[model samples]
Structures are given as structure tokens and as C-alpha cells.
Target: MNLEDSTALQFDTPYMVIDFNQSLKNMKKVQSFADQHGKTLRPHSKTHKIPLFSKRQISLGAVGVCVQKVSEAEVMFDGGVEDILISNEVVTGIKTDRIADLASRGCRIKVAVDSEVGMSSLNESAREVGKEIDVIIDVDLGMDRCGILPDDFPGFLKKSSGYSNLTVYGIMAYDGNVADESRSERSRKVASEVETLTKLCKDYERINGEPQTVSVGATSTYDLWAEYDIITELQPGTYVYYDRRTTEYGASTMDEIAMGVVGTVMSKTHSNHAVIDAGYKSTSIDNGRYPILIMPSGDTAPVTSMSEEHTVCSDANQLKIGDRVLLLPSHACTTTDQWDKAAIFGLNEKPGTIEIKGRGMRE
Candidate 1:
């Protein structure tokens, strides 16, 4: 939904705007893709951080939602999300207790464990609460940031039997590192990884029982991941509000992007030089690319530099003071975190704002 009809600039500058219709379209398209491939869509909530969107995703045939932090789980559970998978490890005692507490209150909490200490902490907490917490062994799968290596997974699984208050939910093998600029190369890497993951799951199930869950996929490899039956669920989050990187990877087109930071030109030193009120303080460049600037006329504006609260563009395309423009972030996940609420555009009537329910839930 674009504000094309001169009725769009009623709001203040430097607002995080969401195209409601486009966001819904993006969600539906991905959900349909997952359904066609017979995979459960458990979108990662870290992208939007709003429980309303999470519930909306669930309503559109998603099984539940995935979050990376215990605090994010708490926020979603409080927002009436019953099933949540904390797709990251919780090694701290307090955070583990929070997870156990949520479980004791009847929220289905599943967490990923990659080390003995994390599992032990979760086990102790769940034991105190007397609740059975589902645990998914995180397999490294070349990420190297977390998870146990594939060769040591069996030993890790063997060791987990001692934890009485925990159940092996399955495995979370995210091929996040399988990203390549070439679509064919990316597809090949994902297929190879999926094949290996499938063999591990099948071999383990042949001896033991079937793993309760097999969660994987990121937006970069979501389409390729859906082609395989090795996994039971998909965990792509950025599909909700694809950013510039999504376009660069060919996972999304420019029009499919549903998020942007709207900023007004506050100062124009020259016709080609203008300062936008939005900068790193409003959006982010963590993905190592400047936010793509678009004028009201839909022409691209080349950004020169971004400081705390101002973005200087060398080629403003004849934009002047008081003119409003949109800047699309390269990394939607990090950019979304900068705002507390989003000014919703493309609605039927006046714009409305929704709180970022899980914003700043880093703990």
C-alpha cells in the first residue's frame, strides 16, 4: 500500500511504515508455498516483534511462531500464543526458569539446546516446576555460531536421556550459512544439507522413536528448503517484511517488500544535496549496505552518508525541503527493532499504529 494520493504525509517524519496489504500478501504467499510442500510454517517473530502479526501468521495456517529469546517467548505467550519454539539456546539459569514458568502455566515451550550446560540449566528449571519441556538438539550444519557438530549428535542425544523433565522435540538444523548469490548454487547447497539432515533423522529414528519435530529454513533458502520432506516445519521470518537483502538474494522482489522508514527532507543545501531526518537512528545498515532511498516519484536517491539522525544524499533527484521519501533497509530484522510502533499504511482508512510487542526483548 503506497501513499500515492497526496493524503499520505499527515504523520510526522522518520516513522517506520508498514504496507498492511503487501505484508499480508507476503505472508499468504509464503504460507501457501509451505502448505503446498506439506511443511508447517513457524515464522520467526523476531522480524516484526509484534504479537498481532504473529497471531495473524498463525491464523493463516502457520502452526505457531519461532523466537530467539526467552523474553520474546514470554511476550508472545502473553499475547495468547500457546505454542512457541525458542529457536536459540538458553544457558542462563534465570532465563531457563522463565521458560519453565511459562510451561507450568500451560504454554507449549520448546527450546533449542546445543551444549550440556544449556540442557542442564533447562532441565533443572523444568524439574523445579515439574513440567516437561521439549528440547530440540541444535545441529551446527556449518553455522559454527551454535549447535553441536553432526558427528557428536548421537553422543549428545545419548546424554540427554538423563534429563527427566525434558523431551527431545527433534532437531533444528538451520542452513543459514548455505546462502549464495547464485540461485542455483544456493539451491545445490541447501539440497545437499537437507539430504544429510534427512539421513541423520531417519537413522536416529530407525533405532529410537521418531523425532517429534524437524525445524529448519531461513528466508534466503525458504523456497529451496520447502522442496525437501526431511524437515517437518519451516522457520523463515523475514518473509513478513522483506528488506533490501531479500531482494538481493532474489528471495523477494522490490515490490514484495512491505517495510520502509519514511523520512522528510529537513534541509536541502543544494538541489542534489538534501538531508533526510532518518539515519542509523531510524533504520540500520547492519547488513553492510545503505538503505535504498526512494522519492515520492519512485526514483532512486543515492545516499551519501548516514549519521545518528540525518541521512545526506548526494543525488536527491530534485527533492526539496518538506518533501517525504521512503528508505528501505537492507536488513529488516535489525531495522524493525529501531521503532517502538509502526505507522500502518495501505489501510482502508486513516493510518493506525501497532505496538512492537516484543521490541527490545533481547534477554
Candidate 2:
């Protein structure tokens, strides 16, 4: 049945829905932005966790897909995505073995490493499988997350030279800390980070040779990074289906957000508040921002509280029992992980189910 029709209301509640048309537009816009700036678009797959969406992104000119875990990369590889990058470090022996296995199976898999230990583990695992794995040095550009310091890149590069089973592909940095700042402030911060990265790349080339890739940026700093001459690739994941935080940070508007939770009003115990079937289990609260309730009257209400099975909304008195509400989640990444499947719909099309193939791939 056509999801745009009223019959869509009869399927089920508390399910994630994606407006395919909006999502396609978002993908195309980012692709065009990257193409115009001479940057490779390697969108992170952790946002949607759907291989079908990854294929869509690739078809729209994305160079490849970026994953956070070896298992997530395996999922994408199984789904026919050939080139995959584990954009985060994988230090565990089991995870490294999986990466080596993928390489032995003819998958072009590259991973990020921040330390000698991680490089050694990856090299040993690759050696055991009689294969070589490509790796990128993850530089900590003020995010203080999982990356080697800019000053420490030389030492790491020297250590990496000893690993014959590992090839140093390039460098990667994630500027996640500047996502919520104003565009001007974010550009300033990104410029500084880009300078550090550029110098590091030059220094590495001087010491050894030119690296293959220099990756950077998130959804917030994508446009800023596009203007730089140093960055070779862009890795912005959330632009596909922006969330409440994206809108709040001015990265995307609410109308551009393509994903939402369709829930049923289960109770109206108070005069000014009501309960819905979706709660923390359905939407993410990691950013301390709750989902916004899209009321039936084309208005909005604030989500006051949420438990495992209930979402309490303030000023939901206009909603009655069995009423439907569309909730825009706070963070699209975590919210996508909460569901195993999504109902994808578009104008003049039937709603179809797509498996969240990369879900629960925390390893």
C-alpha cells in the first residue's frame, strides 16, 4: 500500500520511518557539495546502518563507506560494498583477525590506528592470514578521542614501518567537538585543525613519502573542510538523516530531517501531558535532548520524559488515546541503532522495509 495514504497508519506504531525522497535529496546535495569541492565523499555508515542506503550513497558518487568497527565493515562487505574503512581503531586480537580475514577474502579493507600496539596487532593478524592490510594514522586533532597526537605521528610512522603486513595508507581526523558551535566559530576551529593536519601530512611526506589519503570532517564541518586544499576526503554521516541535534546546531533544518518515530498515544493521565509508546528504547537520549513530538495539528510539543516503553510529552492534551505522533529523535546515529528495521516511504510510493544490517555491531 502507498505509505502516503492513510492506510499507512494501520501498519504499526513505535517504528522508525524514513522519507526516501528527502533522504535522496540529502544524499545528492552532499554528493554535489563534495564533487564541486574536489573532495571524496566517504559517508559514515553508522548513521543509517542499512546497506541499501550505503549502496544508494555509492550510486550517488560517494567514493566508499566508512564504518566504526570491523564487524560493521564486514556487514557492509557482505552487502556488496567493496571499499570499506574502519574509521576507528581496532586493537583487539579478535577484531584484528576479522579484519585480516576480510582482506584475505578479497575485500579492500583499511583501518585507522593511533598507536604502535594497534599497528602491531593488526600486522600480526594479517600475517597469520597471509595477507596485508592497509591502515591510516588517526590523528587526534583536539577531539581527544581515538587518535595519535600530531607530534607523535613521526614515532608512530617509524613504528609502523617495521610491520611488513600493514601498509600505511594515509591519515584521518575527526572534528566532532566543534559540531555544536556557530558556523564562524566552527570554521575557525576547523581551520586550525586543518592546519595541524596539513603540516603533519607534509612532515610525514618529508620523512617517508606522500600518504594516499588525508581524511577529515563531520556533518557540521563538512562545508568548511571542503574549502581546504589539504583534505582529500570528507566523512560526514548524519547529513543523510539529520536529527534534532543537527537542527539545533544549524547543520540542517527540521524539514530536511528524513527520519522519525511513528508512535501511538497510549495514555493521557494528566490534563496537560500524555504518553506515547516510544521511549528511550525507541529514540536516543545520549545528547540529553529529547525527541520533538510532531502533533497532528501541524504543531509540536516537547518530550518531557521517557522510560523504556513510554514517552511523556508536555502539552500533549490535544492528543487522545490511539492517536499517532511523529517524533524526531535527538541523535540519528544512536536512534538508528535502536531499531532492527525501518519503514521507508516516499511520495507516490509504497512503504518498504529495510533491515538495519549494521545494527548491534558494537564490536
Candidate 3:
């Protein structure tokens, strides 16, 4: 894909645009931090599922990649990521079987679980394959998303202990509350969360009788957790494409933002609002009520309103017909899911595009 002379060639009304230079910088920063802290850098691939980005991450000394779904793990494995960890629980029979198959095929795979059902699924699949599947218990520090409480963890582990084909790897606790914008509050939350996981690690070591590998923290709180020496691996997905929210967390600035949506001005409305072709379908608005827009000069334009097919930005008079604009989405993961491919930009040329291999993983 030679994009050197592609020259303003519009494909669709809206598409994902990536800055290769900024992305490389972001990757280097995260990798360097992980190395400095002696933590394994296992970036989450769900942010930018492009194969080229994964290769670059591995080249930057990333031990492996982290994903949430089985299909995502499969895609990354096929893309030359030899080691993978599904940071979330995999309960479905088919998904676990697929994971087992991947493990049999020589991909170093590890999955998380917070329930007996999830463990049984993986154990059964591993039994069928006659192999041992690495496992981690996901703990709920505060985010009521998918992990189990710290107290219920023992039972969850005990139930799966009898399986000879299952190796209890460690615990994965993601404290999303640490991503709070308030610096003092975020620091306190990260400290407490790491402390809690540290206690759990000691307790598990006492009861289960072995050293545990704890994989916790996001890109926002990784710096704090890295200081504690409790977390063994860092799974910060959004660092690859820093979003507006992550920027608020002080992980990266607007210039460090590597992902953007290239959109065209479609309509001129009120004096305060200008509409763009990219909407909910083109750029995901799932993070909150609004999205972040970027201009030609690299300034962000606030999203005043959004619909399925249109997004209204502030300062309508500033935009003209057919004027191209860029947008730094609110949530990089959700926004990247909106595109099938990303235009990878170079230092002095049009952007080269790469396929988002691990998308829409639901069966």
C-alpha cells in the first residue's frame, strides 16, 4: 500500500487516520516505562488491531499482546504475536476450545476467570486437547465490569484446582477508577488498588502455596503501580492511541495522540455548530455524551451534538464546505472498533492503511 501519492483520495465520508510517528513514540514510551519498572509490556491489541502496529510493539520489546476475546487473540497470534493473554474471562465452550486449539498450535496463551463456570469451560477444552492451559483470576477492585470480588476468589480458584491441565497463572485486577482526572484522587485510588492486590497476592501465596504473577493496572495508573513492584505485567491498550479521556488522565497530550478520524464538513448549521459526516457510526460516541474533534492545525474542536449520521462541532463559521477535519475520539478502544482499517501515516507522505484484524469478535 503505497500512499505516498495517494493525494487526497477520499474513500468514504469518514475513516480512521493514524500518525505513524506519534504512534511509535507512544509505543516507545510505554515500552520504556515497562522496562524501567521491570514489568512485562503486554499491550492490549483492542485499541489498534492493525497487524503492523502489533509487529512494531513486539519490535519495541513487548513480551506479548493482551486481548479480550478469543478471535482477537487468534488474529494477533496469526499476525506474529507469539504470546497472548485474554485479560477478560472466556466462558463460552467454543471460545475456550478455540483457545485450546491455539495453545496446541504453540501460541503461549493465558486466559482470565472469575467463576467456576469459566474455569470448567477452559478445563474441559484443555482436557479435550490433552494440554495445560494457563489461567488467571480476574479480580474486581472497583469496576463492576467482569471480575469477581476478592473474598470469592478462593472458591473460584479451589474449584479449578483439580484440573491437571490448568495452571493458575496469576490475578488480573484493573482499577479503572484510577483513570480519574483528579490527580490526587487518581493517585490515592491507584495506591489503594495496588495495595489490595498485593494483599490478595500474599493471601493466595499463603493458601495456594506458590508465587503468583499479578497482571494489573491500565496505562493511566501504570506509572503508579510500577513503583510498587506488585504488578508483573502492564496491559495498557489505549497508550497505542491515546484518547481524550486518557489525555485527561495525564497519560499523553494531544500531540501524543496517534489516532484520529478524518472527516469532511458536510453542512453548515448554526453559528456555534458545524456538522461533519462522521457520526456515531463513523466514530463511536460510547465513552460519554460527546466526542473530540481535531482541526487541521492539531487543535481539538468540541463536539456539541451527535447523531447516527452527523456530528455537530462548535464554531460553525470556522468550517467550510468540503473542509477535511480530524477527530481524537473520547475512547480509543470503542472508536477503533468503528473502523475496519486505519490509514498509517508516514513522516512525509499520505497514510498507508492496515486492516483491523480482530474486530466484532462475538459469535
Candidate 4:
């Protein structure tokens, strides 16, 4: 349905809405950036979490998709994606077995391992399933998250060599901390991290032969890392649905934001404030800010506060009961995880629903 159609309000408020045309533009724009730089595009499926959109990304030139968990990988594989990378560590036995099961079922699945225990667990699980699993070594480049220390990476690789059921595919690093910095600052930080990554890859080659893939880069560093020949792949998920964070970080513009929360003004009792149906439960507050309100009249307002079911807007006095307002989340990835389905609309096609196949796949 046309966005302007009154019938569009039939759907309940606090629902995720995507501009299909803008999403297509976003997909192609990032894909083109990857293509121009001769880097493989493996857009992370965690942002959209929908198989349809992942397939669309593949159609546009993504080599495959990246997922953080085994369940998310299973959802994507079941949805017809052949090649998948679990970009995070899978430590639990059940999760590892699930990955092995997916591999045995003919899915080309690869997972990241940062510790010997993780690698051993995955190897044992794969052995139980009678299948070999490809793995990428996750090197910690200052994030201090889920990766082996750069200096200790060589030892980890050496230890991984003993796992017969695991095939070491390559190396992966995530620079999530640098995503919010200025472009130049982000580039500098990424370059410094890449130096460490490059050294680790070289050390890996010295110990384990040529590493097949040197995967790195998130949405914030996609363009920055694309200029480096060492990085073989780019794993950006948020670029598909640019949010206020991306726009503020200079990675994208407000006009390029494709996803929004459609919330209706529920109360306007105060002159300078109003309440919207969407709140911390509907949109994420991980960025320490509330979602921005895109008024129908092309104006904007800052969400002052959020409760479980209500978002207080600072300048929503123009809104009345039943007036719809679009909310651009501060962080798209977490906001997306809050939804079960997304209402998709395009310039030529009517609105439709796409299930968030990988929603709540935190396991």
C-alpha cells in the first residue's frame, strides 16, 4: 500500500517499517562500494535478520551472509542461503552440534573460534556429526570482545592445527569500537588495527600456510578497509538499514535510512511534549538515546524519554491522537532484533510483510 494511504494505518503502531526502494538503493550502494574495491561483500544478516533481504543482497553481489549465532545461521541456511559464516564464537556443545548438523545437512557453514576450548568443542561436535567444519580465527584487535589477542593468535592457530574435524579457513576481526568516531578518526583506528591484523595473517601464514580469507570490516569501516588489499571480505550489516548512528557517524545520510518504527501519537496532553506508542521495548535504547521522530510535516523532534510502552517526545506538540510518526532508531541492529516482522513498501509494489527469520537467535 502507498505510504500515504489511510489504510496503511490499519497495521498496529510500534511496528517496523522498511522502504523497499530505499533498501534496494542501500543494498546496491554498499555492494557497489565493495565491487569497486574488489572486496567480497558478505553482508551481515544480523541487522535485517530476514532471509528475503539476505537473498536480495546475494542477488546484488554479496558472496554470502554473516551471522553471529548458530541459530541465525540455521535460519539463513534453511531460507536457501548456501554459504554462511558464523562470525562469533560458538562455545556451547548444543550450539556447536547444531552447526555441525547444518554442515552435515549440506550447508557450507563456517564459524569463528578464538580459543582452544571453543575450537575443541566445535571439533568434537563436528566429529559427532561426522562432518568437518570450516573455521576462521578471530583475532582481538583492541575490542577485547570475542577474539584471541593478536600476539597470542599464532599459538591458537598452532593449537587449532591438531583438530582434524576443523579446517582453518582464515582470520576475522571486528572493530566495533571505532564505528562511532569521525570518518578520518575511524580510518586511522582501522588502519592501526589492520596493521595488527596484517601481522597476524603473516604470522599465520608462517605457521599454518596461506590463510584463505582475511575477513574484516563492519559498516563503519567498510569503505576504509576496502582500500586495503589484505582484507578479503567486508561484513557490514547496518548499511542495509542506515540509522541515526550511521548518519551521525558520517557513514550514511538521513535520506538513506531505509528502516523506521511506525508509531502513533497516543497522547498530547502537554503543550511541549507528546507520547508515542513505541518505547524502549519497541525501539532500542542501547545507544543511550531515544529514537528520533520524523514528523509528517518534514520536521523532526528528539525523543526525551522512554518507558516500557511510551516514548516522550520533546517537540511533538504538533501531533494529535492517531497521527503517525516515523522513528529512526539510534542503533539499527538492536532495534531490528526487537521486531518479529517488517512491513515492506516500495514505490511500485504494495506493502507486504517479511518474517524476521533470524529474530531472537541469540543462542
Candidate 5:
């Protein structure tokens, strides 16, 4: 059976591959969006985990890339990605030292902070290295995750400013909970978020001088939030390789998704179920969602469940052993972390392998 990405079909089973052309298109589209809005594009690289992909984002006009951990920042820098923002908290001394070392070596590293401990440690590290580190105040718009709450942010910012080695230049207000599915509702919720972010930026400015940047948005709400002028940087991750979850959120179409796991059918033990050679270890089962299966015949199959090494399709009667299938992710970011390399094709140039340089770099 012939498929559109015939270049990837010949690869061994249970590997990740991307339609390079689609990936580039996605990059260019988002870059154009940022450029037209006068916003700086700093895509979060935690989705792809590959430094090469982060560099490609920079090449496509992204000001820089955002990473979640110090190791990812180091990987990006080592792989020739010049600028990085560790858009998450890093409080440990070892990690903070690593980040300071990167900044001292001219990596142009910045980090997001929600607590004074993060501030103290990073500042101390930068002091030891005799360098300054840019920091973004991470505020919780509603995600209830790592950011400081809106009510306590002014107090926190007052406490967060004593670090002479750290400069608070931006605000990282992630509205991950603003996903309402409806476009109008999404826009309304994002407008509320923008209002809150604008207030937070003013608070930051009042205490810490001028807030140079206001970073926000995910792939689901990037377009909606881009309409606002207060947002200066976009941190959308999954837009690089949108998945089933992104499609479910109306952020992208199934045809526009560029990444998938190529797995070969290994068993059809039951009449109604077919087991593929990939599972949660190969793809990702994040958010309790399984990958969507695409059979060799170019038809879609429903993935019922996945374990460590096997993905089972409960309604896969048309599939058989030896057939190759593409497993499109439900959540692209976590799914991308499962692989160490990707075979990219369809760029109109030579199809080749790209090392997933930041894969498994959780530190």
C-alpha cells in the first residue's frame, strides 16, 4: 500500500517521523502571525525536544526558544541554539548553577520564577558566575500550576526584587486553563486573561521598572491571544507538531498535524482488536488520551488503549499483521519526549534523521 509520506514508510517500525514540509509550514504560519502582530516569537521547544527543531524555529524568525529545564536549555545551546528561556522554575543549586554557567558562556539564558527561593538561588548562581540572568515573573492566570497567584503577585514581586544579579524583565502569564473549545468563549476568556496580564505587567513595572516582555499563550489560544497588544512573546509549543488534542481544541486540523509514530502491526489476536508494536513508551498517553491510528490503507482507526509496549485498537478489524500504521499523538509535547530521534521527510530535499537532543532531559 502507498501512502503520502512514502519516505518514512520504509523505516523500521516504532519510530517517529514528521512531514517536514508541513512542519515548516506550521512554523512559517506562526512566525507570520507573530511578525504581523509585532510580537516576538519564542516557541517552547519542550514539544519537539529536538534542538535542531528549535534552531529551525529561530531560522523561521523566532526570537528564541523556550525550554522547561536546565538540561533542555543546555542541549539547545550546545546544539547551536543561541538564545533560550527556561520558561519554568529552576530552584535547585545545581540546576541554577548550570543555568548561570550557560548565561556566563553567552547563551543568553532567561528563566521564569514564581517564588523567592527560585529568585534567591538563581541570583546567587549568577553572582557566583559574575553574570546577570533575565527572569520573567510567572503568574498563575488560572492553571494553578507553578505560577504565583494574581492576588499575591504584588507582594511576591516586592519580595522577588532583592536579587541584584537577577533582572525581572518580563512576565510569563500562561493561560493554559483558558481553553473553552468554543472560539467565542475562548476569545472572551483570553480577553479576560489579557486584562489580568496587563494589570500584572503594570504591577511589575511599578515595582521593578519597565517590564520588557509579556509572554503568554499555548497553541490552543495563541491565535486568540495574539489579537491583544500587551502580549510580547508567544510560547506555543504544540503548534510545531500539532496532535489530536490540538485538533480537539480547534487549534489545528488532522491533515495539518505533522508528527506521528510509525508502528507495524504485530498481532491481531481478537477479531475486533489489533495490537501494534508501539505503546505509551513509544508514543505518549498524556491526558489519558491515546493516539489515533492510521492504517496502511490510509483510513483512520481508533486506538482503544496503550500499555508500555503495545497499542491496541479495539475496533481495528481491517488491520492485520505486517501492516504499517501511523499513530498520531493525542498530546504532541509528551509524545515527542518518548523518542530520541526523528526521521523527517517531505522537505523536497534529502530526508534524514534528526537527533531529539533534549529528549529525556528532565533535569
Candidate 6:
């Protein structure tokens, strides 16, 4: 049989591989932590972008999945994800209408808004669908990315309050600014933001006469943020597949690092230097974080540089010709998006596969 047709054939350079056991463990552990803390776990599906992963997440007690785009939401809806939150700003027109259609199909849809345009678009779509859509006012806690200023939150909320067709649920303050390197510092910074934002949630309730659901923090600081007295929901995407940068976040141990790209060492040029078939195309090169290499002996190293079809590892002296290496990416989401599907590997059973159905479903 040809290599492509052969089940045991050597894969050409540059393919993505995911360890099923590691990925599942990451999902289970995070969900369990959320359950223990009484916070609803709504993982960002933008990480996996796979319906199978979404199904597994829901089965593990995730309240719902959070998606960044309408296209992603549509994919999740078809994948049997009954609930979704479009966590980013979705403008009016076709996309907003798409959101309405998904809701019409029995998918519970909630969206985040920060500007008058965003609120108007969401409200317009909701009214057209003749449904009361749940809305979360995204607050600019610190990221300065895309959220209404804290001082302007009330005015922003006022715009949506009167719309019976649009239910102002709460606020989503994503503290993506906090660096996870120093645990104490991460907790301190995240707590400060959470304190200020939770107060805003309380203040919103004071004015609106209803409790607000304040969602905050991320996977790196989920442990600290979840324990806080305020947050109602937790959105941690990378926790589904702990990556190199995240492992350094002190969020998970090496044993907990569950995702890697399996590649064969194509050349052993010299001592302590080997070239792997997987490269920048197969794995992500974020520049800020390093790619980890797991040797066949179960030991691991780091890739010094990554090109299109080649990854150079200076510490791979022990690695020999034809040895398969597993690479833990610097960024899990970006790296996983490079693949068409992930080969699920395990020790006992035949490797399974799942299509990355929405890999580039950016539309």
C-alpha cells in the first residue's frame, strides 16, 4: 500500500498530533476545579474548534461553550452544543442575523458588547428575530482590547436596559493583561481587577435592580480567580490543552502538559542537534514562547528555531534517526488550527481521529 493509504506509513513532515489522554485530562481537571468552586465552566471552543471536543466538554459538565465568531458558533450548534456565548464583539447585519437564526434553532445564544454600535447591532438582530437575546456588557477592566470604559459602562448599559427584546445579563471583564509567571503577582493583579469589576457588577445591579453575572479571568489564573467571591463564570480555553507557555504559567505541571505534535526526526546532523519534520507550519511559532520537544525516551527538550518544514533542536543529541518526537506547542490554539484533523493516540487502543471541522471557519 502507498504511504498515504498505509496505516503504518511514515507521515511526511509537518502534521499536527494530539494526545487524547492528555487533552481529556486537561479538560476534566479544569472542569472539576470549576465545579468545586461553584463557578460555571464555559470553555472557549476557539481552542479546539472541533465539535467532538465541544461534546466532550459538555459531557464533563461545562455549562456551555464560548466562541469568538458566528461561524464558530454555527459549527458548535450543529455539533449538538445547545448553548453558546459569542464572547467577542459581533457587528450587526448578516452575522448578527446568523446569531438570531442559531437562537431560533434552539441554541441558547448570549453575546458580549462594548460599544453603542455593538449593542445596536445585537438589539437589531434580536428584535428582527422577535426574541429576547441575552447580552453581556464587556468592560475594559485593563486589557484595553475591546470593552466599554468602566466609567461609561452605566451609559452603555442604559442603552440596552429599555430594550425588552435584549436582556442585559451582566458584564464580561477579561483580564488578559495579567502575566501568569509570578503566582503571587498574578493573583494580586487579577484580584484587583476582579474587585473593581465585581463592584461594577454590583453597581449595575444596584441601578438595574437585578443581580449581574460577572465573568472574568482565564485558564492561567482560573485557580485564583475562581476562588474569588465575585465571579460567576469561568472561561479558560487553553486549559483544554496545556501548552508550553501555559505550563510555565504555573497552572499545570509537566505531567499535565497533554498536547503535542508528533513528528519524525528526519536528520541527525551533529551532536545535540537534530532536525524534525514538524516546523512552523505544523506547530505555531509565537516568538514569545518556546516549543517543547518530547524525546522517545520520555525526556524532552526545546526547539531553537522553526522553519516551514523543519524544527531544529539543539538539545536532541540523544535522539536518533527515525525516532518520533512529540512537540508541545508554544500556543495551543494557533498550533492546533494548522491541522486538518488530530490523530488521537493512546497506549492501549488504536489511534482515533477527529476532524478540525472549523479550523479556519473565520467567516
Q: Which candidate's lDDT is highest?
A: 2
Reference-based TM-score of each model: 0.96, 0.96, 0.92, 0.96, 0.95, 0.92
* Predicted candidate 3 versus true structure: per-residue lDDT over 1-363, tens digit per residue: 112222144556587777778788889998998999899888888888866688789899988888888888888888888888888888889888999999999999999888788888899999999889889888999888888787787776676577788888788888776586577777888878877887788777866765467887787887777887767888888998788888876778867877777788888756767889988887777767466676655456778888888888886556776877776678888888877777666734655677787767654
| Model 5 lDDT, full chain set | 0.85
lDDT score, candidate 3, position 140: 96
Question: Can you tell me which runs of candidate 5 are displaced by over 4 Å?
Answer: 6-8
**Which 10 successive residues of model 5 have the least lDDT summed?**
1-10
Candidate 1: residue 174 lDDT (0-100): 79
lDDT of 1 by residue, 1-363 (tens): 364522274678888889888999999999999999999999999999988889999999999999999999999999999899999989999999999999999999999998889989999999998899989888887778888788887888878766889888788987777654579998888877887788779756864578877889999888888887677889999989898888988899988889898999999877679999999989988877889888888888899899999999997757989888889898899998999988886555876887888989989
Clashing pairs in 4: 1-351
TM-score of candidate 5 relative to the true fold: 0.95
Residue 329, candidate 6: alpha-carbon lDDT: 84
Whichever of 1 and 5 has more lDDT, that candidate is: 1
**Cα RMSD for candidate 6?**
3.7
Estimate, for each residue in 18-90, the C-alpha lDDT of model 4 and write its tens digit: 8878889999999999999999999999999989899999999999999988889989999999899999988
Each prediction's whole-model lDDT (CA): 0.87, 0.87, 0.79, 0.87, 0.85, 0.79
Error of 5 at 315 (Å): 3.7
The superposed Cα distance between candidate 3 and the true structure at residue 174, in angstroms, equals: 1.3
Model 6's alpha-carbon lDDT is 0.79
Per-residue lDDT tens digits of candidate 2, residues 1-363? Answer: 112332254458889888878889999999999999999999999999888889899999998899998889999999999899999988888989999999988889999988777888899999999998889889999998889888888888888777999888788999999988988999899888878988898878976698789998899998999999888999999999999999999999888889888888999878988999999999999999899888776678888889998999887768898888888899999999999988877733666777898999988
Each model's RMSD to truth, in Å?
1.6, 2.0, 2.9, 1.8, 1.9, 3.7
lDDT of 6 by residue, 1-363 (tens): 011111232455345666667778888988899999999889998888888888899999998989989999999999889889988998868888898888888999999887777767777887887887888888887887999888887777777687767888888877767754589998888878877877787679877865457777677777888878778889999887778787787877766765667788899868889998888888887747658787766677777887888888887778887877777788888887888887656523766666888789886
Candidate 4 regions with alpha-carbon error over 4 angstroms = 1-9
List runs of model 6 lying over 4 Å from the truth: 1-13, 270-272, 346-349
